[model samples]
Target: MHELIVSPFLDGYLALRPGHQAGLRLPEHRYRELQAAARTEVPLPTWFAEIAQETWGLDIDGGSARSTLLVREPSDHGFSRASWEINLGCNFACKHCYLGLKEFSGLPWDDKVRLLDIMQAVGVVWFQITGGEPTIDKHFQDAYRYAYSLGMMLTISTNASRLWQKSLLEMFEECPAYRLVVSVYGATEESFDGLTQRRGAWKSFKKGVDAAREAKLPVRLNLIVTEDSADEVDAMVALAERWELDHHVYTNMTPTIYGGPESLLAQSSKHLRERTPFQGCNAGHTFFHADPHGKVSICKVGRDDQIDLMAEGAEGLRKLGGIADKLMLRTGGCQGCQLSGSCLVCRPLAKQFQEAKAPLANYCQHGQQK
Candidate 1:
């Protein structure tokens, strides 16, 4: 099994290992040498081996290193990261989920591999696998293995419902992920199960958490503070500390991806915080998100003008730049709003709130009365 990967990063090259945080920054010449070693019978440079051992305890001087150590061909595709919804299916019935329907559908295995190939071809380096809950996807393991094989660093966002499964844990043990980010709904079973609308969810979540901890897997928690779980926010944070895992607090809930206001009802009015000003981002130019069917969009928040990766392949991404530009323009609802310069929400997000017909105070500054 390969212990290290060399790939083009944002405007540079990085030598990294799966599941490990430390990395070696490679100059262009060093990256080229690794590429050459991969192509020919040349042995890995002593410097590379020493650094690999120092950083990850991996000995690359072994003869197989030339072949096993992945060295990706360079691409100037201008895209470095993407998040894919393995499937919209979930084992849990979290009420606040932004995917309104939570349909359990996705591309067949062959098509899923094709989509991953297209993503790898376009130099997607950092890949995130998500879902209504992703672990349950039939092809998730195969797709995850394939992405890692193609030198993509993977991050998996899930509810920690399936981490206790032996097969999944073994796969993660063999091919580690960049990180497994689990969502923390509540500190108590009554609050958690009630919020997920599922009985016995807290037990399953606790099992998954224990399994992950036992395996020493890198995990982070997202404390989801909705009205049901609002009172236990501190306890939720303590739970993360108890596990000695990193945690992030999420209080602001947005409308569903389909622009439905159902998810907003779960929002805790007391925990609403002012969003940082929109300073813009490289949504399409350098980052994108893919649906289970391989349709690519600029980002999750703005899903218009999707490009079909299956039908059009890597070349399909060309349209994303233009689509991103169009989506970011201060038109539509904010066409001429004098307050838009400091408006917290982006134009696309504002459009969703408008479609949901949410309260005047929900998304607008005037709603501060709530």
Candidate 2:
């Protein structure tokens, strides 16, 4: 069957099969043209009609084809999209890595599948498979296939060092990911290896990108800007452009999700936010994060308030939502703070400081000066 999937973050829609076997990206203007035509009983746009025909072999002008078309919008429930840290293990230990290294085995294959089932049942249509590196998981292929079979749009976040592997590349070729968000640390071998702390990771990363391109897989680059890699930002962007890939630049660094100090050293004072308005976050309302061990929380940063996903199943989601809502509630201190206009602190981070009864000197510039 063919369906129109609308992303809350993007203004357009994608026409995709239930199994995600084939799809077409429809820009906002084109999507609007189709919608307007549908409402006014005008003929479908030539581009969309051609794409639909090519991608799904559906002739929109045909009555039978019209009956088979479906439109799916983002879930109005607590969260429409969710991310899973498939495993916390990694081959490269980047200095700025957020999760930090931990010794722990991930849930069993069956358990991971069960979690995917639960997520699907709860109206989570888009799933982001991430980790220290998701491909490092032994059962990543199995879990990924299971999610794909369940008709979920999957996005894989990786450093791209392992994408050259025959097995991993094959899995991606068979069940294509909705997108591969690859993290590029630097442009040159010296700079890249310096940030990743892996002697030959730069070569592997380049090979992985080449392999993905050779296989015609969709890839997006995320330029991680840190103190060590700042000099290569332009080069990294140039590399992405050379590969004809879309990219985003990230400069903010946070303490490890586990609340460690390692990530603090990697922070760039120039990139730190001096002031941010209190517009609230989408954590509990429309997004959540699941760690490798099945601990579900509202977001990656505020991971302390969590519930066991395997133990509670869907009920765990409810508890998580409640916890997030409660944590987001404004406190007396936040309400009366003089820096409310320019304070970069959010309720969740503020809650972390309150719990520790210590100032988050690394995060808050104004508070630190005070």
**Top-scoring candidate (TM-score):** 1
lDDT (C-alpha, whole model) for all candidates = 0.88, 0.73
lDDT of 1 by residue, 89-119 (tens): 8988887888899999999988998988888
RMSD of 1: 1.5
Best by lDDT: 1
lDDT tens readout by residue for model 2, 213-320: 898888889988888877777898899999999899888766566556676666666665544555677786667889898889888777766889899888668767
Worst 10 residues of 1 by lDDT: 59-68
Model 1, which residues run further than 4 Å from truth? 62-64
